[model samples]
Target chain A: MERILRIFFNNGSFFTFVGLQLLCLYLIINYNSNQAAIAAETWSIRSGKFKSALTTVNGYLDLREQNEIHRREIARLRSLLPESGYNITTEIDSIQDDSLLQRFNFLTTRIVNRSPYNPNNTLVIDRGARFSVQPGQGVMNESGLIGIVDRTTDRHARVLSILHQSTRISAGLANRGYGTLRWNGLDPRRMTLIDLPDYVPVAEGDTVYTTGFSNIFPTGQVIGTVEKTERQPGAGSLNLTVLLSNDPLRATHGYVVQDLFKEELGSLNEN
Target chain B: MRGNDAISNALRFLLILFLQVFLFRQVSLGLGGKEYLFIYLVPVFTALLPLRTPRPLVVLFSFLLGISVDLFYETLGVHAAAATFVGYARQFALGLLEPRDGYKAKSSPEGKDLGNRWWMQYLLLMVGGYCVFFFSMEAFSPVYWRDIVVKSLFTIPVSWLFCIILVTFLRPRI
Candidate 1:
């Protein structure tokens, strides 16, 4: 502090010297437009950077609110689907209502725990009876389908991850052919699709989707992409190694998808 | 700082102030165009301040003198600020040309008592400083730096000539 004083007033009466200079500066700033503009610009740049820094520092504090907003957005989009009218060949009357539907609803949850090394890798999700979550509902995130709910407690549910060896989900291709998607239990990133004929026009890079044949997941939902194909010469069947869209082992958030028409669909299938 | 010096210096101050504002300040040099020039003489009063006057007192007196002139010229504070600058610089100005006797035996600075050479040097420093500062502040912008220089150069000699004529003729009883 004493050094600072010395710098301002090296002479005996530096107080008067400094005070007059400060008064001149104040007057200049008030009366000078060009100088005032420069000053204002400097302040704006400095303050803007400071405000952004402060926001980044507090970003972690708003994570829960941000997550809640994203969850609500996904739920809203879930109940609405594209209309068939977008197709030129389909009749306008055949188009279903594209407005919000009660047929599909979602409740978002977090993955509390999960395992990949086990033969039946199951996920413990952070929603159960308290969130109206039930067994057999398909679970997914924005990237694509992950699993089906297997059991529930008051506040949590256990899901059978698609990585399980016993899992067999009917899959669809862009050409409308059928295949079975199953995890081989060795490489966690690879899922095997089988029972489609080689004449099905299958390609290595073609996308595979859920067929909605079992009424578990919505029709046209993404399953994975074809990675490689194997031909059984005698059986005339093609086996495909599919690459899952997003690694479920690394996923943190989830949504339980409920199908409102599941009972009707099940009864129809039984008949 | 003394009785005699105060009386004599006050008389010189009033005399120079009157002649400057009433007579010299009104003179105009023009070329019949939109251009003209001002003749400055009030600085002579500041230039003739007693050599041994205390630095602080000199600054204060010069400030008061400049401000009083500003009242009539209506360019308030410009004159005062310029005068104060000259007042503060007087010590250093004299330092550039110190005497063997070291500023002793001098009641007032004049061409008669001090040699014409010493007096002219002193006059140049005081008037030159006052004019540069006054015109720079009057212009109020650095873009007119050349303008300030030209005005100071023209003002210095004319003001300097008028001061000699006053000190020699009017002889304010110092």
Candidate 2:
């Protein structure tokens, strides 16, 4: 106790200096409105930034889990697609009582490889027969239609891109007229919508969509926009130059649509 | 003689404290809205304390005087904290500005005891330290560092000038 007293006496000024400054800080932070407000604001701002940084770190840490949750969410949304349901309202037809059956299921797939510049461009998708990705299933991305699935192994599938020369899409303009969408080998970004009647009042920038004439593609999926309209020398049909919306090379992910009634539709067509 | 010195020091403290809190506090040199310069004479008392005075006594005296001024300005601890720091820093400033022949016995730091050059340097240190520490404590953070720096720059020279004049007048004719 005597030694402690001697220490205090020797450095009394230093101790008092520290003690007084601490007391002043306490008073400033407690009594002064401006200082108190600044302390509170600084604390809240620091805590807010800390929380955001924590959330970002947590998000990065659980990326695989988050990806799985997002994939399930996409699957759930795909199940509710209008094209995936078949209307069963027959002789007793009422708006509220119409029954429907599930007809299509969309399986998400990542494009592993694509050859957009090839005359017969094809895309390789990750999911194949093991994931129930069958031939003739339609593939599309959020931007626009992609292509039809051509063949599948147990683990992967090949897709025939819309940029292929032989690929013909039954496209229409606002249900006013119907035409076939065909790509010329020269340009991947441009396609010709042929067989549309001139009386349909086609104009530039009109949107062309799939007409669902076949079981290949869903109804009203956007194909492209009309660039120009041309008339053959003696033909009554109008050829519309369409600027394709989907650039196949830029597409990294797509959905392969499995139509449940595809075999039945094929058998009926065969009959 | 020691009794007379104590009385004179007490009188000097009261006079500098009153002038700082009342007269100099109201003085503003700028045109309008915001004052560009501030005058602080209280730290001069701390600066001019007798060299023989203990560090703790100087600190305590400065704190009391600062809190007295803080009561008038309604800034409870800002002035007190800055004054305490200046009081603590006084030893360092005096040591740095020590005369070649050393300080005279029983003499305080004033233009009359120390040369005018030493007096000017000492006042500059004390006033500059007071302004910077006071503004920093008032702001309570370095986020307003620009305000602290600009105010200190504008206040130091002006407050130093006023302190010089005041200390010169208050200097004893021993």
lDDT of 1 at B163: 64
- Report the C-alpha lDDT of model 1 over B50-114, residue by residue, as the tens digit: 77676666666767777677777766566777777776777787788787776656555645555
TM-score of each: 0.45, 0.55
Query: On residues B68-124, what C-alpha lDDT tens digit does candidate 2 reach at each position?
Result: 888888888888899989988888898898888888876667565578888888889
Candidate 1 Cα errors over 4 Å, as ranges: A1-271, B1-4, B31-36, B110-113, B170-172
Predicted candidate 2 versus true structure: per-residue lDDT over A84-183, tens digit per residue:
6554565457674524556667788999988747788898999999998888888987668889899999999999998888888889989559989888
Clashing pairs in 1: none
Q: Please give me the DockQ of candidate 1 compared with the native complex.
A: 0.05
Query: Which run of 10 residues does model 1 chain A get worst, by summed lDDT?
Result: A12-21
Best by TM-score: 2
lDDT of 1 by residue, A194-252 (tens): 99987888888899999988777878888789999899789888999989888877788
